[model samples]
Structures are given as structure tokens and as C-alpha cells.
Target chain A: MSRSSRTFRGTYFSCMSVQSVSRILAVAFCLVSACTPQQEPDQEPQVRILELQVPANFPEPEKVMAGYPLSEEGVELGRKLFYDTRLSGSNTISCASCHQQQLAFTDGVALNKGAAGTPLLRHSPGLANLAWMNGTFWDGGAKNLESQAFGPITAPDEMNQNLQELVSELTAVPDYVASFRLIFQDEIKPAYIARALAQFQRTLISANSRYDKYVRQEPGGKMSELELKGLTLVQQKCGSCHAGDLFTDNGYHNNGLDSDFSNHSYEGIFQGRYRITHHPADVGKFKTPTLRNVLVTAPYMHDGRFATLEEVLRHYSQGIRASPTVAAAVMQGAEGVAGIPLSVEEKQAIIAFLETLTDYEFIQNEKFSSPFN
Target chain B: MYRIRRSGFYVAMLAILFLAACKEEKEGPAATTSVTVSFQHVVGSEPLQLDEVIYTSPAGDSYAVSNFKYFVSNVKLISSAGEQIYVEPESYHLIAQDGKTSFELKEVPAGTYQRLELSLGIDEELNHRIDHLGDLDPSNEMVWDWDTGYKFLTLVGTYTGQTRSGGLVFHIGGDTNYRTLALELPQPLNPRQDGSSQVLLQANVNELFQGPNLIDFDVMNSSGHGSGPSLIAENYTSGFITVLEAK
Candidate 1:
């Protein structure tokens, strides 16, 4: 009833004249109906809609905020949960433990330690522009953020949390109980916990980088000659996988990381996307990570084998091992050569261009920083 | 006077229509009843007692089932006229061996049902989404956190065979492994308005090893992915569940 009444008021305000009988009726109706601020007519009535501003240069993602819309309360709850160590079994490690804000949400380590001090198998990928990612993780195993949160939280070496116990822990906290009730209007379940964390992560949009500015033709977008050359080289060489303005095609590929795929340790960690798909062609294939903040997010690759951009470039130019499942685009060199031919100058230029992707505003933004601090 | 009479006639007609609508609401033929589907798990002919009973498979592997859990969803009651009456809102059920084994399918129309159509796993549309409550809840440990899908069926136990003597984890899942089972009721199930109908089903654990695909614990000891899960899933299509009775 309140929703329909609001719609009627909106229509009346847009077209009705002050002297019109309909306007008089609307005014009288509003006076009786308590014309206060109302939420969007969603199923969850109390949810205060938080609009995510897609940059002018960036294409709007098809399903940016479906199923779980970004609500002001939900984001705030998620931000708290993201930083809260209570989600972990030991109450020591949180999502923020590995995904820090300063390094574009990546811990500055090749292999970050888990809650139990065990080194994680894969390098912690930076979290930015995740709203557009069709899948999560290096192998794209987890379909989305909601499902992705369960991985690290329950992982024995990671947060090592028993989800049921985590629910009880959060439920014990009066503040969490109140917030969960206010936002979800249901009991504090793992599903709602995931939805909240997902809402916060989806808001981690990083389109304010210098490269983004240059594309948008905005101020402070001036690029040097080398950087422009690097951009062209990247467009030519890396655009097949790291395609589009989002800096990722959001597809899996084998960039010839390894030649063999027989190893099945750690549940086929070395097998790459083949672990998820069980397809022979998918062996050594991994989801193409975004090059945004590539300067800060090191060491590179799925296993974090490369510590610098130079090593990564060298891998593409020469270090690419000949594998059956390797991407066809990676084999762009002369007959015997395995990878793209890139001179030292071109690699340096590409590195310089990639540095421009580091968004200072996003890194220093207090909104994304730890609330406890 | 004629205009006032016309308005009065219209008001009278509206009142009569409202009365008719109310009468229809009170005495409508559309009545709903609930059906209680109960599961009785077994190992061949004997009752499945967790952690104690060691049952030998067709492949001659002595295995004691420590835990057995599976999802039963998309329940549909088929009429003799070939019409399907699907259970709505919440049809997905996670029936665990040690936990809840029975659930009620509410709002079933009064009809003579001949067979029951059920799926062994969550549908593709619902499987990917982890934001579900109740039995489909990810916290139940019936979900694969890394792979982001429900483990349609998990039979965890220890097995001793000629080739191997270790844990048997048949954590079957994946969208491709979702199997549908159609079973004929013992008799016509005509649920009354009083909601007193029960569909009793017996799940023979031996069927998981035997059926179209005979699974040996020696080779296919554990599987979360690959061809092993599909082989185990195929076994359920035939002799896994049977309608014991319908009352």
C-alpha cells in the first residue's frame, strides 16, 4: 500500500498542476499517508538502496547488482564482516588478512599465510572490479562472490572456520544480531553472511586510475610517449585474454605456465582450470586476472612465481613452455620461439603503462579501510 | 428519477456479485492437502545402521557406511491422466542418514496420483546459488565450498578391498551428475482434504554399488569430480529408491 501510494505521488508530482483536483487529492492523501522518505519497493522493505556509480568510460556490467542489491545497511554490515576476525575459526584471520586495501586488496607476498600459518597454494589476487567477474578464484571454481566467501572461510589452512560455529559467534554479538535482523530480516545464517560480504566486495569498483581517466578524456589523463606505446603493445599482445576496459575477458586460458599436468596434489592445484572442468584441454588454464593495479599486486601468476613485471614479460616473450593446452595467442613468435617477441624497451614501456593503472584514491580511500582501525 | 434508479440497479448488481464471490471463496472445489514422504534407508535387506553394519558390495568390498546423505528435489506427483503436480516453493530436501529423513510437501490438490518423479540433486538453476536457507544451506557441510555446488550425495565410510583398504568418500556432485528417478506408487494415492497421505520410500544402499554401473571401491574409492561421480550417479537412476507404499 505504501509503495503504490509513493508511485502515485511521483506521478502526481511529475505532471499534476498545483490547481488541479488530482494535485489537491494527492496533497490530501500525502498528508494522511505520512509522506516520509521511503525505500525502493523491494521485497526487503527496510533496505536503503546504495547506487554504485559506473564510470562514464566503463561499460555497465549486465548483472552488477542482481539477487543481492547493494543496500546502505547491507554494505556497512558487509564491511564489518569483511574485517571481522570472528568469521575465522581462530578469531585471528579475516578476509582483510590476505586482501588488504593499500596493495589494491592483495597482501604484499608471493604466498600469504593462512589462519593456521600454512602458506596458501595460490597468490592472493587483488580484489577490484569484481562486480563484472563471471567467476571467482584463479581457476574460476567458485561461480560468484556469494559462493566464493565460503571457500577461504571454511578452508582448513585459511580461516578454518566451522560455518555453524561462525553463525553462533556472530549471533552472540548483540551488534551483529541487531544489524543482521535490520538488514536481512531473518536469522543470521551463512547465506545472509555471504550476501552481506558480497555486497561490500561488489562496491570495490576501481575505475579512477590514470588509464581510466585517459580513456574518459578527463583531467590528469596526460600520458607520456612510452606509456602510449605500451598501451598499443598491450592492446596488440595481451588483449586476447586481458581484453576490454575491465582489463580481463573473464575467461580461463592456459598461458603456457607449465608443460606437464599429471600432478594431482592439493586437489589438482597445479592442473589449473582443468581441476574445475575436468577437461584435458583446460589443463594449466586459469582465469585471466585483471592488470589493474598490476604495479602493486606482486608476485604475479597463479602460483606467484614471478616477483616482478619484467619476469612476467620475459615469461610471455621466452619463458612460455610449450604445452598442448597453451593458448594459441601466446604462440605469436617466429617458428621455433614459443611466445610473443617483445624487446626490452617494449617491456619497460608496458610496465610504465601498467603503473598508471594504480588508483591512489582507491588505495587511500577511508571508506574501504578497516573500520576497527 | 430514471438516472437514480439506474445507479441503484448497478449498486444492487455489484452487491450480488460480491456475495457470489464470497460464496465461491467459502465453497470452492480447489482444496489442498499435504503429503509426507518418509525414507527408510537400507543395506540390501537389512536396515542401515551407521558406523556398525558392514555390508559387502556386489564387487565384494566390505564397507561400513559412517555417513550417508543425499539431496532429493523437484518432487512431482504424476496423475493417471499424465498430468504432473509439482511441489512448489520449497521442494529441495537434503535427507541425511543421521538427521532429518522425512519432509512434507504441502498444498497438494486432491487427486489420484500414480507415480512420483524426483531428482537426486539440486537443479542447475538452484545449485549455483549458495544463498539458500534450510537443508540447502551451505553450512550443513553438504556443499562443496571450493567448487561452489551442492554435493548431491555423499557416502563416507571405510572400505577394505583386494586393491585398497582406506576411506571411501563417494562425494558425488556436479551439474552433469544430476539424475532423475521415476517410481510407480504401490497403489493410487488419493490425499483427502484432511492432509493424511504418506508416501513411504525405501533407499537401498546396495543399489549405489550395483544397478546399471557396478562401482568397485578398489578403483572408484573417492570422487568429487571426474568420471567417477557420473558413474555413481547413474546407479541411482534404476534401483536406488522404490515407493514402498502410498496411503
Candidate 2:
């Protein structure tokens, strides 16, 4: 083929020198092409590389604490890492084994079964807008986003994969090898892998919900009468801690889950912030999670004991457990104990209001889905 | 062969010239003058000692500061020529229990500075934007992980009749009570040609508890965990306008 003809192919033709092409063949080809009818330039169809665009009003990613910046290469690597079943010991479970995007990044179960097939200690908090959270895990033990990503992967009862072994498995995949080399610009390390997953998790912003629309005052964006009533109740009661667009004040509190720790059997496993701080006063204190998309991610509370929102509302209304660290706001009398007196109608209304915070678009976004395809 | 050798020599000479040009461009210009501004907390013309009783509350309770820490953010040093130099973000200092009176100002362009202005605690943008510690980073220990925002000013100490071992932890923050203090110091001392001069200033911890709104130290100590509006209000009114003087 002539030099120009070879160049027309997709690959670079740098190996062929000018001396390799015959002048006669080049001239003949040029003349023949000119005599033939002109053809349209071949243009490849554009592939949608980005599923999520950084919002204009969204704050710049702060150093590590706010979250590492989301990059295309990092996110792609994270998506592959997220769906790779080899992350589990039996090569059947990954992050997606528990957090399925269709169910709004939470497995549709009252309690998720771990790799050992034992019910997990707590409900899986959906991985949505996690970058905005001050602390990670249900009880606020993990200090930063990078530290939070490592919990499930190494948990013996959970994914049960060693960090070093996981890295080795990922390095063995040629595609992953190439992708990691591009994303991290070095051989895959556990920290970099965790950081990449965090970058992807940060991009899981779910601000386009019905509540967001109502707040923004977009056309056809308004809450129903029931939703409005529920919203008012939420504003009066829950808005103090679960405040603003992020739906969390990012503070730890003892919401009186169980006052009686005398059972002793559940003491060590479910001691909450006391496990991290080792202070008796900190016992049963857990970080208040953002209530955004509460309707989808069910089996509520740190222990996932409440199977439904109705049960959660009931717990707030009457199921308070008195403790030394129970929030002073929740405590009414001198003995320091109280629960919100939400009525049945009011409970339904609050649930209605919470459902409005669910963003259907975020759950179905192809960008955040498994990249195995 | 001679022509090839000559061309090779010319290329080497051009490469050397290119490298020399690149080096000159990279080095740029050196700073001609520099000044260090030191903020000292002083009460009644004397540096406020840690245990010294500065001010008493309305309720006859004896008050002594065991710990005092606060954030000073968005600092700027104004030049005599009216040029303003912005301090880098996270360039804040926490006045701790352990005495460290001076914070070294970095990357300040050499010039005669007229005044210094700083925002107390964090600005609203930075407060909402950052997740952990917010404006209070390594410079301050005002960060309470259990709470969301920085403690604008923390004055924790024992009251005469406190039952607790540590006495009390007076942590204050949130946008409601944080106050921005700005001051004009003595005009530009001659900029040291060697690019180093010290500008000393002082803060009075006593003034932080007194003035129009008197904080009942005993009541404040016993208020128990979390912050109260009354305490926050007192913090805002008392420590709002910190007087700055040149030494």
C-alpha cells in the first residue's frame, strides 16, 4: 500500500520509510483515487465517557478529608474494582455483592449476609454522597474516607479478602493492570485502590431528588399536601440534627437505642462509639446518618433492628432507651430521659416527607453502575 | 565527515544555550524585603498568664482559664502602597494552653505593611465546603469531631464548686456566634533589606470573658455537654473586638 493509504488505517504507520514505497505505485494510487468519486470522511460515533458531571455549585474537593478529586481514570478503575468478585475469598462477592445500584446502592435485605453467611452486625448504609459525611461506618469509627473503604474488604465475616491478596489479584488482570497503570501511574497498591474507590464514591451525588426540586422551585416541582405536612413535622423535630441539603449535621449522638446493656452478650459487638473512644459515657453513641434516600435503604438504625420506617418512627416516638450519653435534647425530665411524641398520622407524614428525598435519577445513572459490561 | 561533525557541535551548543535559558526562567526573582507579624494576647498592658484571674462573672463565681483556643482565619497583610497580600488558606493559628505567641507569616512579598486584618473562626464558605475540622486544621485543637464546626473560642476551666474531674470543656463554634476582628497597626516600619522583620501584636484573654455581656463561669461550667445560645452569645459579645497594638 502507498504511504498515505497506510496512514488512512487507524494505526500509526511510522515504521514505513519513504524508500519502502514505490514511486510508480504511489502515483498510480493517487491518480486512481482522484478519478474515483469522493467519499465522506469516516467519523467514529462518540462514546459517552462521563456519566456524571461535577455540578457548578458543588464545592471543590477539599484535601483527603472532603474526598480525593474524582477523575475519569480513577472512577473507571473503581467501577472495575467494585464489581470484581475476586475481591471476596470465594471469588463471588464484591462491593456490589452488598451495594447493588438498582436498590439504590443497598442490598435489598433486612440484614446483609456476610462471606461466612452470618448476618452482618449493622444495616449497610447506602454509598450515596458519602464524601460529605464527617465520619464513616454506622457508629462513626472510621476517621476518613480512605479508612472507611477498607472495613468490608478485610472483615473476616464480610468479603474476607486480604488487602495484599486483593491487590495481587487485581494486578494479574491485564486490563486492570493497564487501567491501574493509567489511573494511579504506578503498580497497584491498597491505598491507591481505596483512594480510587473513594473518588468514585464521592461522585455519587444524589441532589436531584423531589425534595431538591421543590427547594429549587423548578417547574412542576412542588410537594404534595401530605408531603408538605410531613416536611413541617421533619422541620420541627428532625431538622435540628438532620439539617440542610446534605441531610445530616454530621454529629454523633446517643439516640437511646437500648438503655439496658446488662444483657452483656451484645455489649462488645454493639457498643458503638464507646468501642473507639473507650469512654463509658460514649457507650451507645453513634453518628447520625444522613436521611437522604431513607425510603430505599431499609432495615434502619446502626443495628438494622428496625425493619421499616414505621418501626423507626415508633422508636423515635416511644422506644427511647435512657443512657448517660443520650442527647440532652431528647432528655426531658431530671432523670434525663425523653422520646418524641409523634402521633400515627404524623409518623406517616414524616415518612412521606423522607420518601421525597429519594433521587430516582441517581439510582439509575449508568455512570455509577458496574463497568464489567 | 567534517560537515557532520560541525553540525553536531552546533546542536550541542544550542542545547547548552536552551538549558541556560530554561534555568534563568525557572529561578525568577528573589524577594527584596520581608516582615513577620506576631499576635500576642495581652490584658491591661500585660501578657495574660494561663492561671491568672482576668475577669469575674456576674454570679460571684471565681474564674480561671485552664485552656483557651480559638481560630484566626482569612488573614491579610496590607502594604503601605495599598497593595493587599492574601494569606494562604489553612494559614490559621490556635492560641493553645502551651504558650506559643508567634506564628511565622510565609510567602509574604517584601514591602512596608500598613495593617493586618483577620476573620475570627472560619468564613461561611469554608465552613460549609470542608468536611472535617473545616477551617480549624493543624493550627488549632478547636476541632470537636463529635460536632460539625470549629469551636471559635474555647475557654475551659474549673469553677469553685465543680463536681467533675476536668471541671468543664467550654467549646464554642457554629456560624451564629463567630466574630471577625479587624485592626490597623502602626504604619510600615522600614522593611528589612534582608527580608526579615518582626511586627508584634497582643490579645487579652481577660477581655474575652468581660464587657457588656458577663458570662456566669459557674453556670457555664455546669451547663454540661454541647453548646448553649446564652454561652455562645456571651462569647460573641465579649471577644468580638480584639484590640491590636504595635510593640
Candidate 3:
């Protein structure tokens, strides 16, 4: 063949091969596009619905929730994690097992009974308005609810479940596995589980109390004349440390339950800030808990020694034990070893004032309840 | 044949365009240079030595230093070229009696520095953030865990005098009416080309209690060890940098 004819033939073949490859590529691209899932144009975007209602004076809802941003997925996952019995080693106890809904989220027993039916050292504090609480547990051992959740789960006497095992069990549940993956985006660690629970707990905002309504100037929310007097007394005596909308100042104080407790030094369980600092001065110091739901969360103090609010009032009135750690303000008189002396009328007034802090709306909120139902 | 030549020319043009684009990226801005700043703690015109004799307080309370520890953080270096380099957050260096007082500031651009800004203790924000940096994290030691604030300066010593208390532990750091102190120093430091400079800081432990109403060591050790006076704020403000002679 001539040189031109040979070159022309080669060009023709190359062009045909290139066209064939392009056709093949186009077919593959179309097939891939057809196989991929297509979202419906009319389909609504998946939005998380947080059903919790915020109070009027309770700061901005978004700002309050900054510490714990809630979502439909996170709340659902957290609720499942909360009530899941499989979280415990025996698969018999869940968080709801101790923190029952009917009993104001507190186990009715004077002291919490653990997994092995062992009596807990402290009371199972009611978990109603934990979002406002600076510390958790009666003695204020846990700094935040995130750290507090770990205590019962891993306690030998409590749930008695290992974190690794709990994670494995959670991952085994396909629904939980998918939910956790969605919420955490592949970082499905145990700490995230605690964070989600903390977030859900934070959504448990309790501001619909008679006192809250009274403060907001809402109808049927006005406090009685007696309650007003009691509130004034509270402000004068207890308001220094337990200040602001959230009753507790989030500080540690020696309330002077007793100088000595059944052969154990008051300083031992006073474990206040000492546990964290290992300092001698912090002996017998315990964080001050919020009095928001104090009326329902009875059997007060770190030891749950006082079964009645009356007893707690009386203890402050006359039962203070003197120690070097006792705040100087409290130890003003009585030769440096005395509790604030309150009269019977004053005690009753304080109790009446504390009752106003109880929010019935928080207890009956359906959103904070178990989602399984 | 003309069509073939035209196709070759198009390919050559595409290659040239690719090379031109690559050249722009290769000739970018000059790289950033960094330097290190080393801080040395000196007491009384000399590097603080272990077991050195230093007065406990202004009450003429004298004691040989057994253990002296303080935190230095929030470091900032002002370069001569007008560039400001901030030390990494939560950088805590303990000036112990064992003679490890040097702290190195990394990634500081090579230039002469004019001034060094540092806080003797952790700032208020980091001090209140719980479980932040962990134990031995400068914020932890400098903080008063019980009161929920930082301890600006902690001075512990033994004293023997009428006005001297026994073993004294002065834990100070509170913004309360009588607790916190804020001190600033305007020292001119010429950091070299290597972006490294050593600034000497002297802390007069005695000057801490040299005011007319000097801190009574005995009272400090006794009933007022952790209570009363709230002298930390006053002392830090009055005598933070009594002697700032650069070495």
C-alpha cells in the first residue's frame, strides 16, 4: 500500500477504538447513576424534634442547651441507652431501674440498693433539674452529670457492667448501632454515649413550678403570704451560698451533720473537695446541692440521715457539728462550735419556701419520659 | 497532513499551559521562620538555687528554702519586627528549687523581641474550667480546688520569730475583694536572629511581705493559714516585679 493509504487506515482504526471506549465509558456512567439512590424532590428534610419546653425566665434555650445540644436522633439514642437493661451485666437493671419515673426519678429507698442488693453509701438523688446542677450525687462527688453517669454503671455494687462490654452490647443492637453511627458520625466511643445521656438529661429543664410562675408574674402562680415570708428567711440565711435561680452556689460547705459518724470521722465521707484535691483543709467538705426539688428529694445530706425535710431544717437549726473546716461565716457565734439556731416557726417557713421550688410540669413532661412507649 | 500537524500543535499548547500553571504555585510567598524563647527564674540577682537561705516573710522570719515551686504561664513575645508570638495555651513551667527554671517557647519567628508578657499563674478562664489539663497541669496546682479559682501565688515555708508562724502555706488566687492580683512588666528584650532569647525573672519572696503591714508569718501559719487577710491580691499587685533587671 502507499504511505498515505497505510496512514489513513491506521487513523481510521484508532478513531474507531477511541469511539468504542468512549461509548463504553458513557454506558458505565449511566448505569452507575441509575443504580445510586435518588432523593425524592417532595421529601422533607430529616429534622430532629426536641419536645422539651423551656421556661420564660430560664435564659435563652439555645444558650442553656449549649453545654448539651439535643437532637431527635441523640435524644432517641439516649433514651434507648437509658432504659436498656442490657447495659448492666445481669441485663436486669437499667438507669430507670433506680431512677424511676413514678417516684420523681429517685429510687424510693432511703439509700439506693445496688445490683447485688447492696445498700449504697449515699441516697439516690432525684434527677429532675440536673441541667442546672453544678455537681452530681448527694456528697457532690461527681462534678458533672457526664461524670456522674459512669459511677452507677461501673460500680461493683451498682449496675456492675464494664464500659467495653456495654459498648459491645450496644453495637450488637443494629438499631442502636445505626443510631449511634448517625449521631456520632463514626466516633461511637463510650464517652459519646455518656455525652448523649448528659445531653438528654440537660433537656430535663424544670421551670414550671408554682414559685417559677409566681416569679414570672403568671396567674395562679402567686405565692401565699406564708411562702413569701419563708422565702425572705431563705434569702437572709441560706441565699448566700445557695444563690440565684439555681438554688445551690455550687460550693462545698460543712453543714455539720455530726462531728462523728458511727466510728468514722466526719471528714472521711465529707470527701467534699478532698477526693479531688487530696488536701487536709478540704476535710468534711461536700458540694451544696440545688434545692429546686428538695421537697420531693427527701432524706437529705450526703448520708441521707434526715428522712424528713423537718429534720433537715432542725439539723441546720441545732445539729451542726463544729470542725476546723466549718465555714467561718457559719461559725460566727456559739464559741465556734454551733449550727445556726432557727426557731420552730423559722424551720416551718423555710420548708414552705422550699416547696415552692418544686415544678410539677417537670415531673409530668412527656418529652423527658421513656420514648420506648 | 495539515490536519495532523494541527492536532500536534494543539497538544503542544495544552502542555505549555499546564507548565505555566505549575510555575505560579512553585514561586509562592516566602516561608515563615520560628524562634524559641527561654525563661530563667532568678531570685535576688542570681539564679534561684536549691537549699538557698531566703527570708520567709517580712516579719524577719528566716528559713532555708527546702521546697519552692511557682507557675509561669500565658507567655507572649513581642518581636522587634513587630510580629507577636503567643505561647501555646496552658503552657505551665514550674520554677522548682531543683534548678529547672528554664522554659522554651517554640515556633517564634526569627527576629529581635522587644517585650515579654507572662502571667505568674494561670488565667481566670483556665483556672475555673474543671478537669481541664489534669494534675500537674499548671492550672490544677495554681487553682484552689475548693474555692473554684486559681491560686496566683503559693508560698510555703518554715519561720522562727515572734511574728513568725510555724509552717506557713500561703495559697492565694481569688478575684474576691481581697484575693486576686494582676501585674504587668514593661521589659525591653532584644531577641537575636535565631529567634531565641533568655529573659531573667527575679521573685523576691521576702518582698512579698515587706509592706508597712507586712504579712505576719506566725499569724499566717496559725489560725489564718488558709483564711483571713486575703493578702495574695495586695502582695502580687504591690511587689510582683520588685526587681526586673534583665540578665
Candidate 4:
């Protein structure tokens, strides 16, 4: 038989490559002699059930809180609901509206307007490895993920959704109702809504960065000479605040962003940790965010004042201003200077190192992407 | 062994017979009365007709309310003897200006009560755990958005552009600012052992401006962002509960 016309084990043949033709011939040759039919590989889902895959070298991640067990059905339901717009009052915006997957879950803007077109004061940061976070939001106001999901959904300026009516609305959709029933085996409720959302968010693990791979000593994970030098500098300087494998100390600090509070508009000056802690000392403190995808999640800081990593590095170098509650470390310089000192070359090296922290695998993970999209 | 088995069977048969006899005698679950509390909203002394450009704030701001919604939870009943009976799950309720009527208590104990109490908004400790707590669901229009807290009361409408410009929006929420205010009113009730009763809660919209915290709509037209809402919200706590019409 012709190579193109040949078939073996119910598989069609096309001799596009010599390797493929040889494999086909070998299979045919085997069949001609004496053989049993080969079986086709089992069909898998487009997006498989993802578990929190911690790297071998990485420390044990915080456990998913009790009562909020990560179930396959729940994660699947949460994945669907994360993109569903019904959570918004206008039904036009969903959690995924601001948290798109391409830009490391951020919408790629300094600040996106809420559902009511009210310009948000703070920029929406990218979400990854959130199960390890002790608190939620820039202010750390939300106690847990359950409380965090409700913020944007019911925020007047954001989705402005009425969570009380959300269950009924979701139940009206036959597919959603069926899916919810399959997981909960009971009526849809707001608690379940929060649970499903939390479940899905827990699956957003991003531990495959080049830096992570480098730590694992895997191929393509080797750091360049500049990157290695920058890593040494980061360990000496930035490592105090942005520490550990997650690249976050999980503590609040005022990074000497502003000097005078009067410069900000009324209620516009975010009081970060003070709002949650209510301590006078925490006047301008903000929770240290994870720099897992620092390359993609630009327009940095709580209010997104810095637009580029260069600006961020510059802020660390010499841009920090005087503030009463500014961290002692940030204010430490040759003569108790406001900001840290950095040369032009050092800044480039640091930027190069920060770029290695990018994890293309996590950002492009199909399971984390909106099923609806 | 046979004798013991015979006696055990007799005991089981007697137990079943006794249970069946009790089931036949009793009508259903325990005979308790339901007390329906109807909310009657008013502007000054007249029935409140929403969207009517008639009501004027004490601050001389001519305003017409398009939306007036507030949460009421943890309703309690106190008898003449000071015996308290609290509604389970806190009896969270939403009383809005439009299309909202009486909230019924399906399992209220029958008694002659002289005092009735219900909180204006959700309790502070219970507020943070707002997931699917029935009526306190964020999906309910009564929510103030999630970041800050639940809005105890929302009075949204258009007012004269003297104090502030544009549409008047007052979303009163937060824990330390203006928490739940428990309103205790004199309520004389005589409920039957297996019957229902009614309690009409009249909320005078005018009192919202007249109370100790005199609200000037023009100056405080909108306050969902800062400590401004608490000013008007404080006044509202006392002003909202006008009367308790028990029937």
C-alpha cells in the first residue's frame, strides 16, 4: 500500500515526515507479521483538575483553611463562577473583568473603573498563590478569601452586585443550577458562592518561575551573570521585605512613598494597614505584595504610582521621601538617608533579576483561564 | 433467653403504641404563634410616596427620594415580666421604601408582652461574617459594597445642589462609625396559644432630619466614602423608629 494510504490500528497515515513514515512502517510491518490492535490514548479534559503543586525545594505552602477543602467539583464550579458576570450588579462585569489571566490576572492599567464607572482609588493587583496570604486587599481589610470575594462584587464603585439575590439569580441558569447541585447537592447559597470562589482562587498557584526553576536546578533555569549579581544585591537589600520563595515577607511597611499626607485628596490618600490595624503607627503601611510576576504586574505600589520596574527600582534607590512611619530599613542609608543607594548598572542588574521571576507557565495555564473565554 | 426476648418485644411494642397515641393526639409541631411586623413608612405625618418631589429636608434642601432601604436584624420580644424571647438566626430584615411590607416571625411564643425591640442594622461582630446569612446576603440590595462593610441604611435621591453637586447618595455603613442601633418601643401584645398577631412599625422619614443629629441634605447630600455618613446615620438611629402600632 502507498505510505499516504496506509492505516494501522484504526489510525490514518500521512507521510509528512520521514520519522512519522518510519513509525507507520514499523507499525504496519509489525501488523503484517502478527499483532493485536493498539488502543487510543484516553481523552482528557481541555483543562484538568489542578492541585497546588509545590516545588521540591520550596517550603510547604499554607494549608487551605479548614471547612474550605479544595474539591475538583468545587474548583470547576468556582472557575466558571469566577468569569460569570452575574456577580456584578450591572451583570456586565465579573471578577474576571478586572482580573484577566493574560496580564498575570491584572487588567494592565493603573486603575480600572468600577461597575458604576467610579474610578477606583487603588490599582487591582494580579492574583497568584493567594492561599498563602494571611490577609486580602491592599489595605488587608478583608479577613479571608470569603470576605475578599464580596468586596468587588458588592462594592458600589465596582460590580455593585447584591449578594443576597445572587443565589437566586445563579439558580435561574439551568446549567449553573445543575453544576451547583452536582457539587453542593443542596440549594445554592452565598456561603457556597464564596466557598466555590475561594476554592478556585486557591488553585491559582504560580511556582514555575525561572527563579523557582533555578532554585530547583532545572535546565533553562540558569541565571545569567548579571542576574546572579542582581540576586546577590536583592538578598542584601530587598530580601528583608520581599523574602522567601513567594517573594513576600507578608508584613506591612511604609516604603517612603509620601512625605506630607495633605498632598493627597480627601479620602483619596489610602491609609493602608492603619485601616485594618487601627494603629497610629501604621499610618501609611501597606502589605508587602508577592513579586512572583513582577515583570507583568506593572504600575506598582498600593495606589499604582510607579508605572515601571525602573521607576520602582528608582524609588528604592533614591526616590523615597521622608515619612514618620516609614520603615527604618527604607530610611537606612549612609547618613540615615530617605532611600537606598543604587548605581545605574546595579539598577539594570536588579531589573534583569526581577524579570527572571516571571513564570510563563503559570500565566499561560489554561486551567486558570476563563472557561467562558 | 426466650423469656427476655418476649419481655423486650413487649417493651418495644408498648413504646411504639405510646408514640403512635401521642402522634394521633398532637396536631403538628409545637403550637406557636407568628407575629407579623408591618413597616409603615411616612414623610412627616403622611404616608410616604416615593419619587414624589414634595419632601423638604430641615436644611432647606428640596429633595425627592428614589430609594430608601435599611437593614433590621436581631429582633427580640420582652414580656411584662421582663422575660426575653429572641428570634432565631437574628431575624434579619430589609425594610425598603418601595414594595416592602411586614416581616413575619413564624415561631414567636404566645404571650402578653409590653416591650418589643429590634436592631436598626446588623450587629458588628456578626457583620464581618457576611457570606450567605439569609437576608444579610451581599446580593441583597441592602449591602453597602464589600470592602468597607454592609450599609445599615441607604437614602439615595436627588437634592438641591447647594451642599454638594449631582445626585444625592448616602450609603451609611461601617462598624465604628454607625453600628446597629437597637430600638426599644412600648408594645402591648396579646397573642393566642395557636394564633397570629400583628405589629405595625411606623418609620417616619421626616424624623431622619429632625433628630439630635440634624441632617442637612445639601451639606451632607452624599456620604458613602468617609465619616460624613455617620453624622446623618447617627440622627437616623433615633429618628427612624417613630412608632410601634401593635394589633
Compare the candidates by DockQ and give the number of the best one. 1
User: Which prediction has more favorable TM-score, 3 or 4?
Assistant: 4
- Candidate 1, residue A282: CA error in Å? 0.9
- Candidate 3 matches the true fold with a TM-score of 0.53
Supply the global lDDT for candidate 1: 0.85
Error of 4 at A197 (Å): 3.0
Candidate 1: regions farther than 4 A off: A1-45, A64-66, B1-30, B84-86
Q: Per-residue alpha-carbon lDDT of model 1 for A1-373, expressed as tens digits?
A: 3210101112213333556857666645654444344656674548688888887877776485334668898998999999999989999989998999999999989898897687889999899988888789999899888899999999998999999999999999999998888777777999889989998998898999999989999999988999999999999999999898888898999898889889999888889989998888899999899999989889898888999999999999998888888898899987746899999999999999998889998888888888889
Task: Tell me the whole-model lDDT of each prediction, alpha carbons only.
Answer: 0.85, 0.64, 0.60, 0.73
lDDT string for model 1 (B1-247, tens) is 9999999999897566444444533354447677899999999999999999888988999999999999998788878776635444457888988998998877677789998989899888778867678788888888887888999999999999978899998898989889888888989999877667899999999999887888888887898578888888888878999989999
lDDT for position B206 in model 4: 71
lDDT for each residue of candidate 2 in B1-247, tens digit (9 for 90 to 100): 9999999999897565444434432253445334565666554455555776543434555556667766766566666566545353345556554655566565455656676767667665444322222234321345433223456677776666333233645566666555655566665644564545666756665555555555555455643233463465464455544435443
Q: Kindly indicate the candidate among 3 and 4 with the higher DockQ.
A: 4
**Tens-digit lDDT string for candidate 2 (A1-373):** 3110101111111224555545544654655565556866554222123334534334433344322445677777777778889878779998998898877788877688989999987777778777666677766765666545666776778888776687788888888777666555556666566666776787788878888888877655689999999989888888777766677777777888887654423324477777555578877777777788888888777767888898887788788877777876565434654788788899989998998988888999998888777
Better of 1 and 3 by TM-score: 1
Residue-level lDDT for B225 in candidate 2: 32
| Rank list by lDDT | 1, 4, 2, 3
| Candidate closer to the true structure by TM-score (higher is better), 1 or 2 | 1
Q: Which candidate number would show the highest TM-score if scored against the true structure?
A: 1
Runs in model 3 lying further than 4 Å from the true structure: A1-54, A58-68, A138-141, A260-270, A328-337, B1-247
Per-residue alpha-carbon lDDT of candidate 4 for residues A191-296, written as tens digits (9 for 90 to 100): 6788789889888988888888898888879899999898888887888888888788778888988765543343434776765555768778888988788888
